[model samples]
Target: MDFTSLSLAYPWEQLPYALFAIILAFTIHEFAHAYVAYKFGDPTAYQQGRVTLNPVAHLDLFGFILIILAGIGWAKPVPVNRYYFKNPRLAGVLVSLAGPLSNLLLAFLCFPLLLLADQFGLGYKGIIELLFMIIKINIVLFIFNLIPLPPLDGYRIIEDLVSNRTRAKMSQYEQYGIFIFLLIFLIPPLNKLLLGPLFQYLVPAIYRALDTFWSLFL
Candidate 1:
């Protein structure tokens, strides 16, 4: 199937590159969550077979389709049993943080390689295009998941830090968060207030940081 047909900007030839980026981003993010949970003594994800890099292990069919259609999506959430942790609070925070952190780390590593590909002209056209998609997708994944909304990694991190009563309150709204998210995107004013700065400012800031870091060594 021609995935690029879904994209209005890029040519159809770039479909493979975009698909690779989405799969890699989703796989690593979920794997990091599962791995961290296992490291912290939670065996739930391991038992459920999520502690692997296989994209199928992480991808949610509906979410992947949304990614292709709208430039954003999600993966299956790794099952984590925090009660197994020696210090549930610390372990919980770390495990929840791993997913987004993995994406940021990926963006960091890809930036320099992207520069080299561009400078040396190594398969410049396709390779550079692939790396750019990979970097952008990873950054978007990292930032998007950091919103302090229920069911997202960011809210889990907050759940670990905030009082138990507050966590309970947040948990009550968890089921409605996705519906609320869709509404935010559908409503222009809400979308502008919430997502506008993310794309316009934060994303560019990260790119600038990547460029500055590589410039120092080059």
Candidate 2:
């Protein structure tokens, strides 16, 4: 899973821009979560002042490094007390879903500029690099966050859809969530056994979809 086999540049020359887009997109995602949570009556994130685009407000150091290494990255999680909401389970799921949805929205919003560059063939090297990083990062962010593991957005989405009994049962696993996540990252057998097959399909699907969208207006 090193950069060498990913066929990406060392990202040496694009390091600054890559890092900036990663930080900016990640911060925006988290900020959207906090903002939506606040709107739905959870003041926890607001009190902590997480409802802003300032990367410093939402940056997680280890998470940032993972972005540099092409690992699925994360931002500081915004706190939300679902109890404060009119419909706790539903609002909670919405807040959880907001982060990745924000990233997709950003990709689509930035789509036109990339297409413009592609259309005119203006500095193809730079534009293609920008498009690649932005689109791939967004796709990875969307898929990684959607994994139905504890403490991830998909868990909440599942909670919202399933019975209260099931939600309560799953809640017990939250304490070990990060450990489970690390195991998936560090244990070769599990990564090879589970993640490898999943990504074999997702990677190409994401790229094809991105290409389809680009061809529409480029």
Candidates in order, TM-scores: namely 0.91, 0.85
lDDT of candidates 1 onward, in order: 0.86, 0.78
Clashing pairs in 2: none
The clash numbers for all candidates, in the given order, read: 0, 0
| Lowest-sum lDDT 10-residue window in model 2 | 2-11
Tell me model 2's lDDT, rounded to 2 decimals.
Answer: 0.78
Candidate 2 on 1-218: residue-level lDDT in tens?
A: 56445533235687766886788788878998999999998889999989888899999998788757745566788888888999987787889899988887777666667777777887556876777677666766777778888678887788888898987887787768768877986677887788887777896786787668878766
How does model 1 score by TM-score?
0.91
Off by over 4 Å in 2: 1-10, 70-72
TM-score of model 2 vs. true structure: 0.85
